[model samples]
Target: MFGKTPAKEFRFLRHIAFPLRIFLLLLLISLLLMAALGQYLSASFEDYLTNHVRDMAMHQAKIIASNDSLVEAVKNRDSQRLSEIVGKMATGSDFDYVVIGDRNSIRLYHPNPQQIGRPMQWTKPGALEKGESYFITGKGSIGLAMRAKTPIFDEQGKVIGVVSLGYLVSKIDSWRLDFLLPLVGVFVLILVILLLLSWFFAAHIRRQMLGMEPQQIAQVVRQQEALFGSVFEGLIAVDPDGVITAINRNARKMLGLSSPGRQWLAKPIAEVVHPASFFTEHIEQERRDVLCTFNGLNVIANRGVIWSGDELLGAIISFRSKDEISALNAQLTQVKQYVDSLRALRHEHLNWMSTLSGLLQMKEYDQVLAMVKGESQAQQDLIDFLRGFFDDRQVAGLLFGKWQRARELGLILNITPGSQLRHLPEGLDSTEFAAVVGNLLDNAFEACLNYPESDKSIELWLSDEGNEVIIEVADSGCGVPEALREVIFDQGVSTKTDAPGEHGIGLYLIASYVERCGGIITIEDNEPSGSLFTVFIPKVKIIYGSSSNDSDC
Candidate 1:
């Protein structure tokens, strides 16, 4: 029942999630910045309050320090005078309480008339000994307050008594409320403005998205489908239940289906195309970009498991034809088998010839001569042709295989030997190296025989550089057109049209193999009027062997 449901859901989420997520992330960052700034400003304001109270205490101490008359009055326990002086000082200043303490640790004068004659039992012992200022915070008659002590001095600057000042801390709370309340209100206003901006952005994005109509959106989707459908690759989608929910034009054609809605679920997709088909598991497991083969067609299939968070949806699979890859593999396999057979034949034939030579050398010539005149004489040229066909032992058998194929195509072959050359590279794999040479020679012969000429000849030349082996093949037939020369090595581009079921992937395979074997190939215009293809294979270092010996056939 889930028909193309997950794809649409994924598309919807992709469009809507992007903008909303961005807004939330920005909002989070803004909130963190505002919180940090608020905490810092609050701490600075509290410190400012504490310092102001301390400054008032120091100012009171200095006033007493400058007045010798006030110190003399405090020393004489002049309560009326001290009280009057302290009351006047507290009048204009921010202090709410004041006290004068003498050297006997007794309160000589206090702003409160009732405590004037009382002992200051709360005075600390180290207050005078340490000669350091002290600050205290407590709840007083006037709510919360901060108190501090400062020593007063006589004419000689001796600490005779202390002037103590107390200021209402609650006043700091009132001051902070006066300034901070308005500031926080303004910040809240700014926060509202930012929230409005965020809302406007979200709305603007929504409005832009709403500009496109449903039909216009559908048109865009259809255009995408048409574009992807026209390509050579195939696209398929399967549901979690293993049902084929969608198949593109190429995919349908590739599967050779006539009807619509290919029901592949519960039916084992192998029934529709075959289980051995590549890309089936990608649909089952929801994995992508897997290389697979279908029937004889090589294809690269990409799998994407459709998932919504932890929820598993169906899978979408897309595939492109890899006929070139399959063709290359097949060609290499054929070359391997062909070369193996030739090598076996060479060993067998050498044994037979050696026996014949021994009999003739022993002067048992009558039997040997008769045998030579029989089948040996007729097959001598063919045997000699194959023996000298491939000079490089590692690749000789492969060349022999291509020779027969060339002759059958009515193309004349010419082979010339090189002087003893450097050994082939040690790292080159024997079978792969042989395949490269054989494939190139085969392609050259095919190109030469492309012309409808009664007479055609292909010439081969071999030589050696200091550390490189060179091969040149030239044909006396129609050469490749200059315009198509650059594209000849590309897969599926070929000049041959007569061969059935051939997709022109041969030269691509040849070039791929040549490069893999550490060699280079170049096709150029021949001297008279033909194509000359040259190959250079680097010579590998030899451990215990001499350079390759050459022979021409």
Candidate 2:
């Protein structure tokens, strides 16, 4: 029987191989067991048959011999008469011989006619001399048989003759062939059942093992452990009791632990919790990322409650080092800002190309040249003006691109002349400034769409005179109301009812960039009737240089 056959208890059979191997094993065992059982049963049946036949033959012979006529015939040496009686009695049965003789143990009748009137050792000597009726096995001219001898008596009650009958042991053996066939059939059935059970259970075990052997599963487990340890983001878990339950290697490394993750096991996380109130505040705020200082290093972390069934089992925390995340975020923000700055410009470029194509079809070569020349000068003038404020070409490109798109949006976009942003410390590539400037410009352009084209204008002023890059973007559009100013830069706040998700990210990006750069941004009213977003980025001394990748375009 398979071990643990109860449902829901799964056991992988390590010894069971492929299906063919299981079949062969079951076949071999079944054959061996059936052969053993068959031998035992056959031997037992042979003994039983011998006893049964001997007892039946003895009983029948006694019934024939006790007759008065049988005694008289034997006493007269009446061979023919005795033969008639014996042959008549033996009819319609499997008896091999019926012999009648005086107590001298001589044969009177046998299937072999020549044995008549000859002496027979029908049974052992004691059966005849003592005139005792008994059974025994004998061998004579006939091969071997189980013979029964019964005594006959006249009215004086003295033995006058012995009647003997036998069934050949070989005949009994032949009859057992009928039993052997069905026995073999049953054994074959058992063998087949064993084979089927083997196949089914073997395949089931293989599936339970996830189509993998134990050694392969062990290898996978080890690989998974290594993967979890090598992951870059940190992970931590605490129980409902605030005990540290699970912490990965990355979590320990990110938290600047001198020991490994195990050293903190089962200990209260409160002892080393960053920002003492982080866990409480996170749970209260419904699980959001928080900035905290861990062991003197800044970290961004999130936490959640772990649950099992309906029970709150614990909390889980994931955290990582701030420097790497901040750097990655900056790169992503810069890319997004570049895309946003170009998106509007790209939209209007299609119109410009269409106009130029129409002009070319008309064969107005002079007009075409004049138009192209004016466009090139305008582009050059914007670039020259931005470079005059900040020598970095990346910043200059952003300002030029955003202004051109702002103009297309029908906003009178201009830069304040001689603003001291021209004296920005030599080292600023202005990626942060670019993010802040581009997103705000995009936001300002969108604000103006709510107003008529005549009321729209964006004036940007920059100065670096006070150890800061002071920037202001003034849009003559709907001014920020007092209530809205508090959360104007929250990621999903939008004044436009056009569509969701399309209009909110730009201002949020500007706010995030300003915060990470240790700069300040404020939204206030412009002079007449619009909004002013001002950014004051504290000056940081930085050196700038050109690289081989730098291009004039």
Write one digit per residue (lDDT tens) for candidate 1, span 293-368. Answer: 6655567777778775666667767777775455556566666658655665566567669979899789898888
Task: Write one digit per residue (lDDT tens) for candidate 2, span 254-275.
Answer: 6667576678988877786655
lDDT (C-alpha) at residue 171 in model 2: 87
TM-score of each model, in listed order: 0.38, 0.46
Worst 10 residues of 1 by lDDT: 544-553
Q: RMSD, each candidate, Å?
A: 20.1, 15.2
Q: Per-residue error at 52 for model 1, in Å?
A: 3.0
The CA lDDT at 2 in model 1 is 94
lDDT assessment of candidate 2: 0.72
Best by lDDT: 2
Off by over 4 Å in 2: 1-226, 237-245, 249-259, 267-337, 340-350, 419-429, 489-505, 541-553
